[model samples]
Target: MDKKINIYKDVEALSEGFTSLLKEELSKREIVNVSLSGGSTPKALFNYWVANCKESIDWNRIAFFWGDERCVRPTDEMSNFGMTKSLLFDKIPTIDKKKIHRIHGENESKEEVQWYTSIMDKYLPKENGLPVFDIMMLGMGDDGHTVSIFPHQIDLWNAEADCVTAQHPETGMERISLTGRLVNNSRNIVFLVTGKNKAEKVKQIIEEREKFADIYPAAKVNPVNGKLFWMLDEGAASLL
Candidate 1:
């Protein structure tokens, strides 16, 4: 795996760096397809974009997708898509409604997975029979989980489908997530991780890979034909 680690002094700096990176990517491509993750970590990035770059970027050419979402109504605070809409999408009026491809988290888990999979197949660019997202912004949990692929349910990482239904290890709440197969096909994969609580797991997954590969679900994210970047705040990179 060709992995690159970038550590920022704080969350604000990390958010700015990510925003700049996204802006650069969007400028380079006429149409950029990005899959976003939901977490406390990305909330700052969303806000930063709204405040600084919202008007400068060409919103119409950028299509939004999600990496995973909890099975909840769009109005629910727990909904990933809801958080994103409130923070980012709602602020960008120029973004076309058709470009915002959200998972119907209220639908049945398996049925939602199938619905999302078909959407991906129809819209995403395919390379080697797999959808290749232009950019995939992901966040890692303290448990070394990425997206909805928790450590206890690591088997879901290798699922053959582009998307699958996942159950949270502790809560058993249903989630629809993009499989590792689809994530690995991305053109660029960025892990935006923050907080001191995630320090050890981040160190284990990035530095001590061989030791934690079997246990850390985040370690399984190795882009076959794209660059993998770890954008961390000082708190998250302390153990590294």
Candidate 2:
């Protein structure tokens, strides 16, 4: 139940707010494993870091992973890895390519899930038998989904595996996501959400007054031995 909510004036300020936290964690940890999220808000953050944090932050000390990825070619427009590569990795030539442990979305679903799960086990530090990430970035869908686990698939939050394949409710596109067991075990869980579209669910989850608010995967983002944060822009926090 420990949570921190930060409301920013705009996406620019939101980017600055998260960078402050990221910098603090970087200063404390030798190797920071960050689980990246895909969405417009996070896009702003990746761009902000590449442009503003390039000089101050040491790319060598950080490793990048994704919270989830669509089952598509990495070059596809819907590919989360594609977006992050274009925005952050491509901009920072000094970044070590080996530090990026991207999910092979183009690879067959079952095979890729097993590969990524093993990669995480090998790279991340473990606590309570689960890999612990320094930071797990998340996004809240309009329907209150997070990490590709739709409201209809809320049960997957506590699935047995560290990673699971989730099918998009509407699109039916498959996605590989770090299950809640793994995400909640991380050292830090951050929800970087924006836009007016997110206001309704934001209010509901934060206040817990709306009916079925507990059903949201985003609402269950409690870190057992870590921290939970919701960094929102004015539009997203409007209803709060």
lDDT of 2 by residue, 98-184 (tens): 999999999999998899999999999999988999999999999899998888888998899989999999889999998989989
In model 1, which regions exceed 4 Å deviation? none
Model 2, stretches more than 4 Å misplaced? 209-214
Candidate 1 shows a clash count of 0
Question: How does each model score on TM-score?
Answer: 0.97, 0.97
Per-candidate RMSD, Å: 1.0, 1.3
Residue 49's C-alpha lDDT in candidate 2? 88
lDDT tens per residue, model 1, 1-240: 777899999888898887777788887888899999999978888888888887878889999999999999999999999999999889889888899999999998888898999999999989878988998999998788898999998989999888998889899999999989999999889999988999998988887777886798898988988889899999999988
| Model 2, backbone clash pairs (residues 3+ apart or across chains), number | 0
- Whole-model lDDT, model 1: 0.90
